[model samples]
Target: MLERLDDIDWERLGHAYGTAEDVPEQLRALRSPDAAIREKARWQLYGNIFHQGTRYEATAYAVPFLLELLADPATAEREELVGLLAAIAVGYDEQWLPDGLPIAEHRQQAAGGAELLAAAPHPGDDDFDEDEGDAEYLASLSEDDQDRLYTHVVVAAYDAVRAGVPLLRTLLASEHDLELRVMAGYALSWFPEEAEGSLPVLAGAVTEALEVGATAADGPDHTVLAATALVAIGLLGGAPDPALLDDRRPLVRWGAAIGLARAHGPRADPAVAAELLGWAGGESPSDDRVPFLDGDLAGFAGQALAQLGAGRTVETFDALLRRIPAVSGVEALHVVGEALKLAFPGGALTGDVPFDALDERQRRLVRQLADHEQVWRIDGSYFGNFRLLIGEYGLPDKYVTLRSYAGQG
Candidate 1:
């Protein structure tokens, strides 16, 4: 059966990647009594087969097998096994890890590797203070464990101020694992101030990832990481290359928007603001024109718009308000409100006048427009006076009366 399996068209398996029904045989082989057979089967299941599948299916099947491998004491070269396990962990949602998996173990492994690189003499050694405590911690872990620990530490340290700067600088110059290098670029997000020196290299990594084509969604991790780093660089008030905003991937575009928002100061370019507005309004005017606004992309875009300040016009404000009502759930509302407050606080209202100044007829209209359960909520107060009025107004029919007073003020 194993020999026949080898001859079977593996390409056909790619098409079958997502269906849970086809997984049992692969799972059985992964647990085979023969170590070689088990290892081979597991490798095929995750590396070749799983990588080719949709993210949902790949994660569902690969996670259990990876966790079992991690739990098995018999798996040799524990460092290598754990490193592979960490790679697998990256593949699955972080929420899936078992309670005792020792996140610290992964961190230690990543940190240990970085310390080895840091120990090597370099030109910028004078700029960084050597901490004896940190050095001692790195020394305590095994060399193999050290590599793993160092990689994770690099990932973590990227979030810190003093630690991330020198570490990112060192990683960018070193010829280490491509994945670790990619992770270092991600870690750069915490140190936006230092991003001026790092952005070009990070962009190169993103370009390379695009060139390599899709291997895993993990493949796009580097691009996302680099794009995020670019955003940080922009936030620290540095100008970013506008071309970064035109990447084929929406994630990359989202990152560029965030970076531009961060960089936009008192005299921000109008073109930049317009481009961001275009993204929020979607590419076209049709009902189906809603852009992909989920996960980091939505949050980043919303926050970026807010950072653009009072430049948004009345039309833009009305469009955004309409979007607020159409958007589902409280979280979406929160994002829309936040963006509106940041960019067009006064414009977010139904009419130009303040809520307190509206006459009895206008107030009644406002209340009617606010009647929709989805649009009305007490917590809408965060958006200031305007969002509050919209939340108060329940009926769309009364909007005309409200609009008349709104246009006058």
Candidate 2:
């Protein structure tokens, strides 16, 4: 399957860490009989080619080899293999969640770099001043040019993964490995361009999952397969069969409701909103590994509520408020962000205003969130996104500043 592994000039390609000459060896190790060796190779691959959601020049080159491993039935840990492809295609799904992958716009933006690519001098050209490497050359260019180049690389990686969507569809349809099928379902969700071919298989998976009662003899929650398929359908701009909403399983029902809410947006049935609100405030699914929203069903439900234009409603505000304390760090940040948006759309409460300036409900919501010390105390890499969101609303992102703004200090 990897006969051409050595044929590729991997040394010329670069990953997050350096020359990708070691990538071939890592790929070879994936087929090793030793589980520890395979796992070590997997982490090495992740750290290098697709490190921290940033796809490198080598990432696109590695896609076919990874897909080949996935296709080989003898491959161990096929789920992780498919997941790595998904990560390479889209760095972090959270950035695209509830709205799905912007495949057309992304491709358009990537193609806009054609002029840059054309004008770029070859290695032999006098103007080819990238003596240090691609990084130095990129640093020498204007920010716009740098963005275009990076976007080009990213899109190349994404398209490479997209090329394997048909294979992912096949895997999704296969019943032999339910976990792998579910992983494929999540992976397919990122390739909205392949929706025409993927949706049918995903729909079939939903039906198959339901027919199996989403259960196995050992008691793993096989319902996630159905839920994953439903969410993928919704992310691809399609809705699940409405009849499934009436299915007997709670998880299936949540999937149908969330999928409908995502696909239809504000036009979704009002009942779906009610269902999401309930789920958002209720206990999150026990399976922390459920694909979407990091398995925080409550967090996703809150985000979707905001999407449906129900964020302004008192019900959503209250539900999110109930959910905030139960979650911490980014999960709480997501819930609070939605709550803030719902309470004050279009960056309301940005001007100098006394506590009395806010309406009673807004004041109440702000006070509750401000007092939730858990969400406020978090600090680290993930906090930046939360800070940006809050800043847009003219809210202080720091705990002390927030307390002062809320008139607590």
Candidate 3:
């Protein structure tokens, strides 16, 4: 399928590593009959071209080949390939979310960066370590060079993955593999520009999911398929079919609520906001992680609230306060961090301040946290991010110090 794979000069391009010469072999290995070999190559791609959501010059070049592999019927791990393309296109979903991808801004920055880079002198080989990777080489560059190069490569990678959105749309019709369709739908959500063509396909997928959910009562849970499509519909600037908001499955209902809230904003039904708040409260927790919002439904709800500009609301604050004591795992980290940021904007807390000096919001937050000491008593690893987040706001990161600061000690 990749007949012209060797035509490109991979060695000239750079990924997260030094050179992208290894990318070609990794691409070829994706078609390997041995699962282990294919998996090893997948990890190689993840660790190099798309390392930690940082796309590189070689990332753009890899897009077409990855799409080809995903399109090939014989290819394995096509789902993972779809996810990789999504990651390359938008990095983390939260970065551009609430307010979707700033395509115009990015395009402008990329154009400006291209101009700046075109006139700028390229760094000499001596400026880099002999064994330095692309990231290290980037670190050695001037701030302007760094921004220029980053914008240049990032936008290129974004557009490269975007070119394959049509192909990704076709995967949504795969009848048997619901997960594959879900992943494709999730990937399609990032490309809002493709909304004109993709919206129909996504809406059709949701209809199909509804039909599946209706007749296949004894079959697998297809709620995710509907959820993904609804979420994508919202992300693409269209609200989902409003009736799905009352779907029997909580996840389906949550998805519809999130879609309505995102698409219609302040004009959305007030009930939708309440529904999302309920989800945000973690009232009926589930270990079943959906593909969207990092698989944490509660975290997704909380983030959606943040995106809706309701993060600072008294209702949101109270809901998050109630959610904290019971929350566990990495997902809670996002929820807690969101609550703290909304409560104490821009590091307003000081270690030396008396409790009376704090604002009502800050005092209320500290008092609630002080009351819920179990959140602090959880395993230390659970609060690694919690501590960092609290420290960022110039607040005490320990339970004892927090109680003292709240004058509750």
Q: Give the TM-score comparing model 3 with the true structure, all chains together.
A: 0.89
On residues 225-263, what C-alpha lDDT tens digit does candidate 3 reach at each position?
888888888989999878877787887888898888788
lDDT value, candidate 2, whole model: 0.79
By lDDT rank, best first, the candidates go 2, 3, 1
Among these predictions, the greatest lDDT belongs to 2
lDDT of 1 at 38: 62
Span of 10 residues, lowest total lDDT, candidate 2: 122-131
- lDDT for every model? 0.44, 0.79, 0.77
lDDT of 1 by residue, 169-228 (tens): 455435234544544554343344455666666656555555553455443244544454
Off by over 4 Å in 3: 115-129, 132-145, 286-289, 307-312, 345-347, 368-383, 398-400, 407-409
lDDT comparing candidate 1 with the true structure: 0.44
Query: Which has the better lDDT: candidate 1, or candidate 3?
Result: 3
Q: Which stretches in model 2 have alpha-carbon errors above 4 Å?
A: 112-132, 214-218, 310-312, 348-362, 377-392
Return the candidate ranking by TM-score, descending: 3, 2, 1
